[model samples]
Target: MIAEPHLPAELATLLPPSLHALCVTRRHDQGDRLFATGARPAHMFFISEGEVVLERASPHGAATVLQRARRGFVGEASLQAARYHCDARVLAASRITRVPVIAMRTALASDAAFAMRWVAMLNAEVRRLRLQCERLTLHRVQDRVLHLLDTEGERGRYPVPAGLKSLAGELGVTHEALYRALAALEKTGRLERQEGALLRVAL
Candidate 1:
């Protein structure tokens, strides 16, 4: 069932009144498929809780994850598409807001303040995707882990190693591969797993 959305007070205040009025907040369970490839763009979403992965299957039948969005907008780039080009999967129980495409377009065209916010959100998404591309260029699992830590951490470390499998998923690798990499790093005294989703780099 779609429940009322829970957005940060500041974000709630920033949403243009018209767009905000049309937004539908709801709860989506894990494994829900919000949209599929080639579907008409119906709504733009914001994740208030949990995660969603934007993935597309390759010609070879392997899934290539384009984005694993935890917060903010998920399909900002597809709001204008006649049909969605990828699958939107919910990876965990989540709160989300779905703003119909027509409402989004209206706000972007008629509301200057909302237009600026939308542009800024799109720019941020681009920067994140670029970083992911750069991370994907590395051949080694350890390199990928370090790259994620470097880009996503605050001072060279994540506080916990709790989500190793999820980490592997984000890196487009299997759970076993991430486990092996973490084990190897531990053997080399390079990384240590700690409590509370913490993974520390041993210096």
Candidate 2:
């Protein structure tokens, strides 16, 4: 048995034993490219620590963050695709486990339990993406910011250890707009920005 400490706790327990030998763990620094758009999918990445974002660039050269993964898998949809649709970039210094895509697909075909868990994980991500879509439709930055705190926070506190710039991308807003919204909210006592988190003030 591979020691639990060797892999992320989530993967150590979730990945089937047959695929264990094929997993490799590595440390990635911020700004490192894990994979690029149009590249063949080679590995499924599990974020053991820190963060990564799936990003795409438009023809005009503007970049958009499609997904931000702090834990669990990034680019789950890549499992079925011939090539990656977006670039996976390390958003922070991170520890990651890479599982060979071929081995993972084989395990899914042969192991019913692991396959079911993978489906459930994808379902949860779908729900988060839905919420993100709804947030993007709101016109006000404060409204979107509040919605994030309401949905994703624990006990009305959302940690921003990665800082507001990262949170801005997640909220689908520019950092300048996010800063303005937060400032207005703080002045109105609508929220409090602590050392590393945002706390929604009780009504």
Candidate 3:
């Protein structure tokens, strides 16, 4: 698993004891439809294990993966304005903590340290999304793929079997096209496909 460097211990501690203590778990495929299109939000989630994919559907019915959340990461967009901006799906069996928005808001108001850490976390997420947008605008698919590997680091290898289609869709490319681009990169020694759908960057 990739280490979450940006999560702050203090922030976790500051969460309401009730929220921090709640236990929620589901099979790998469950919770895939927790959020309906334009669904009103009920609670935010703190993922303790596994990953969740946030996706949005286009008017033409194409689904696009918008983001992925891993352990120690909190999904707070649901707490904002009582409406979810995208659909959330579990990519693997997951343990999550459900935090009521009202409770979270109260805790943040009362805890200065938690508020600061929360702001920092949100800022980091914003920066990451901005970088993704920049990469997606690149003229070449290879460049975009390389940029993703570089940002996610060597351990955050790609071409994951279960998520490849979602990844390609997120990259705005057909799965076949993404595969061809990856093959080209492999031939040039820019990346090596491993046994478990992991792609290691040679650089």
CA lDDT of each candidate?
Answer: 0.76, 0.85, 0.66
Better of 1 and 2 by lDDT: 2
Give, for candidate 1, the lowest lDDT window spanning 10 residues: 156-165
Query: Which stretches of candidate 1 lie above 4 Å from their native place?
Result: 57-64, 154-163, 184-203
Q: Each candidate's TM vs. the true structure?
A: 0.78, 0.84, 0.74
Cα lDDT of model 1 by residue, 64-179, tens digit: 88777776787776766788999999887777788788877877788898888777867876787798889989999888888877886556665332256666777878889888
Candidate with best TM-score: 2
Q: In lDDT terms, which candidate is top?
A: 2
C-alpha lDDT of candidate 1 relative to the true structure: 0.76
Total clashing pairs in model 2: 0
In model 1, the clashing pairs are 2-26, 3-26, 3-27, 159-198, 160-197, 160-198, 160-199, 161-197, 161-198
Across 138-167, the per-residue lDDT of candidate 2 in tens digits comes to 999999999989987789998775678999
Instruction: Score residue 19 of candidate 1 by CA lDDT.
Output: 64
lDDT of 2: 0.85
Which scores better on TM-score, 2 or 3?
A: 2
